[model samples]
Target: MPAIADRTDVYLERFNDALARFADEPTWLLERRKRAMERFLQLGVPSLKHEEYKYTDLSALADGQLLFATQLAGAEAALPSYAAGSSSDRATGAGPQVLGRIPRGARVQSLAEALRSQPDLVQRHLATIADCEDHALSAVNTAFFSDAVVITAERGAVLDEPIQLVFGDGPTGRLPRVLIVAGRNSAVQVVETYAGSGTYWRDAVTEIYAGQNARVDHYRAQVESLDAYHTGRLQASQERDSYVGSFSISFGAAVARNDIGTRLNGSGCECSLDGLYAVRGDQSVDHHTSIDHAMPHCNSHQLYKGVLDDRAKGVFNGKIFVRPDAQKTDAVQSNKNLLLSDESEVNTKPQLEIDANDVRCTHGATIGQLDSEAAFYLQSRGIGAGRARNLLTYAFAADALERIKFAPLREHFEALLLNRFASQES
Candidate 1:
């Protein structure tokens, strides 16, 4: 058996050496990384018995299955969605690319490239969203971040196309981070796509800050291998009167988990989180989201949907916290699941923590099977079982896709959906 403590200590030591190789980061950023590494050492992986991770068993990862971060398995491997005969579309459907929008000015370069060309931008927002002291996952990512992408929208600019940040599967593990900052009055959309050739472990961290009066649209897509393991965390801080819209789709990993947190720190800020998770075979997927209202007059809404088949398992945990000063705040959260097989299962939890009596906050979660009546009706017509299931899956997921307004991206997602369904059917 692998010595968990010894292995983790040694990994941290090697990670330190790796940081020396990329020592060109700013002083403040480097110090922040140091702090995070300290925390990771302090709070090793939280136990499954922990209130937040109760349903999932992550001990296997700590048992040395996840400690050794390897390199990309096939250097020349293509994206799964882009693979010649593979089609796997989730809630957002399918598109030519994983993310629907990406413009030239939106910048999708590596961390080193950004450090050299756009130092100030990186300096302003890189490690701010996920402070070293706040989240352990962010700290872990900071200690191991191999490479990353940085996106920013200039003041007053509205980009129609969303940006895609992709990382492929490999022999080794991955630590990918993305930093997005929307200048005041600007509008932009960003898509993050994770797909690789073989089964691998992936840890993705994203930080987003929307300036006062800005509008930023975002989506995170995970379509890794059936044997792959994935963990992600998205942290956002919105300014006064700003708006942030986020969507996430999880369809592929053997074991996948996501942690998302949004903060409305300024009055009049608004946030919307829309997400979908689909599982099949022996896969398991989990999502945890939090919305914090810290100021007055802010608004937020969260909707998460899940589809499971075979022996797949799904989990959703959502929470909304309204602070004492956050009067007149409006928040709502809901989670819904569609179980397709007798062996499939799902666990969902939605909670609210309020300190302000004037705030309106509500949350709920539901687990159920697909509408059999609808499926039977489709079969009663000319549609076969597989096609009927596909049609109904599309219908169940269509609402989330409709949230996106980009015409070209929408069409691409539809075509992509057909391909994913085809692979599953085959």
Candidate 2:
């Protein structure tokens, strides 16, 4: 455990700086930031004693010892479509890269730009969907966030391509926010990519809103510096008959934590949350997810898997809450982990709180090493022992990969996963 720093003054400075930068921002947003700053001060950074953050420590991060505490450069230049087989620009220190193309008519704008052009749209949804009081990280992000990406689909519009938002950390830390809204009957996909060149702490928040009967697919890839500290929160609200799917891939960062929450505010909403993480070499990854079934007949499915090696650590805590009125709800949650090294550790917990007697809910968790029998069977086929082990490890993670509906994105992640396994073998 590291010593805790008094960040009250630090956050006060940050809040003042943000206010100065956004002096022209709407009064509502400014007031929100003021309130959020107060909340941040009151809550402070969560210590290991904090139940929600018990697994991943943030002392170094809170003190800005691990991060440079640098200021945001400016509005990020639009990233080019990522090219296949190319390393991320942040990883390679190369020029910008592009992957999948966004569909025509879909709107993707930086929050700064949105404020200028679509202030009403940004004002209506921004900071309105997420719970600021539940998490200190959320409050901090809300108070200090300076830049963000916003994407939207008009009512009844169908987007063929997914929108991608890429971010790279600088010498100092960065607080990036994302807002995505899908109008009634609209369909769209959003991909968020996080990477960096140097050690820094990144606190990010992404909020998604799905209108009645809308469909939204969300994905995130975290490949920051190996020495970086990353904490993020993702929240979503779905309307009647709406659908949302979230996919998360985490492979980098010395200390990484993700808090995901979804609220089924309307009946008949459906959601799927899936994640895969590969951590090695003393790194740590933590994921906490909550699905709130607030209305009747809402359905949710969640699965999170991880592979840890070389003294690495992983944590998963998943919770589902079914309100009294959420009758006939159907929910399933699972967390599975594979330990490749005896020294590695993983803590997994799955929880369900149901108030409706007629609702159906199931939760389960499993933690173990790679199957020795399966490895031996493969080795007997003339494959090298190391190769056999790697194959099985890849297969274990492939389940979540296969669930990705986007072919190009799936391939990209597969390549990264294979590269990760190969590196571990060496």
Candidate 3:
């Protein structure tokens, strides 16, 4: 963790290394990488002075304590093993499985593999959704990503099982990317899991494209180590009458920030964004989201909740935009926080910008402590105060948890939440 006085050289070296290693890639991809690198260098690291980053600062990241591995060794054995099947599989040594719970009809490939195999498809939609020119972190990922997970569903295909992607990293840090493409009228569910130990950084980005009338259920569960630093961005582009539901659940990292953006590009499209975050100790978690209605007759809904204990801090900022051409748009946004300790704190801001008079838009935020009356009611029913408090907290989180459609994934998160509550009580 040597502090480099000139961080620009370190980043430039990494960018150059990536270009050299991937020199055989398509010309279009190489040009894209060059553009991303130029934008990243120009944008640099965002400080608290930036309005979008006013609540979170990247001074520590810019100080060069993070290491980016130039050469990867023993990569196969370092892969992550998932908890497939039932909760019983969570036991030690369950063996590593690829494409866990993936249906037979669905296609999955690694970025390197996809570039060599499905170059046309990869080139068509690699950097379409993410706004790399305006976002520095996304630009950095676009320039330095070593590999990615690519999943695609063909036209009219329906997957019966959920697709799971488990990612792990060593101390050198990792930059992983993902692209999900669903064809016309297809439907599928995806679960992305992030877990690691020790002090490292995980910078991840995901781009999703939904064809006409397609449906996608996307979920991200982040459980990084308490000493780690994580920042991620998810961008989605949806077509006519398509539907996309995203669930972002976080319970890890000393400093974690997530940026989610979705554009309803066609008429009759629908998007739903839901998130739940529980943090304790000195952990800090921030979530910023934007939903854009670019066409007429589109709908979007967003709900995010946080439960903070000990000295943890949380931030939630959500915005919805309806363009002038996007008449008959309906959008809603809400952020709620519950504080279990006087030392804990939260900052929430919800905004709506509507350019169309025919649109229906609303946004609001709420931050408060537990209800004493409810606690008293549970105490009168012969329940201990501690147990009653746990019940109330779980109930608050359930509003967002129950939105998960996958049974196994939902059950797994429920168990983790229960264990977290138990630990906090003890």
Global CA lDDT computed for model 1:
0.75
Q: How many steric overlaps are in each model, in order?
A: 18, 6, 0
User: What TM-score does model 3 achieve against the real structure?
Assistant: 0.91
Q: What is the lDDT of residue 306 in candidate 3?
A: 96
| Model 2 C-alpha lDDT per residue in residues 163-254, reported as the tens digit of each score | 66566643223677888989999998887777775556788889999999999999887876787788988899999999999998888889
Residue runs of model 3 more than 4 Å from their true location after superposition: 1-5, 69-99, 170-173, 423-426
What's the best-to-worst order under TM-score?
3, 2, 1
All candidates' lDDT scores?
A: 0.75, 0.79, 0.80
Candidate 1 regions with alpha-carbon error over 4 angstroms? 1-4, 63-69, 75-109, 116-120, 132-134, 169-173, 406-426
Which regions in candidate 2 have their CA more than 4 angstroms from the true location? 1-5, 65-100, 170-173, 419-426
Q: Which candidate do you rate higher for lDDT, 1 or 3?
A: 3
Q: TM-score for all predictions?
A: 0.88, 0.90, 0.91
**Candidate 3 local accuracy as lDDT?**
0.80
TM-score of structure candidate 1: 0.88
TM-score of 2: 0.90
What lDDT score is found at residue 386 in candidate 2? 69
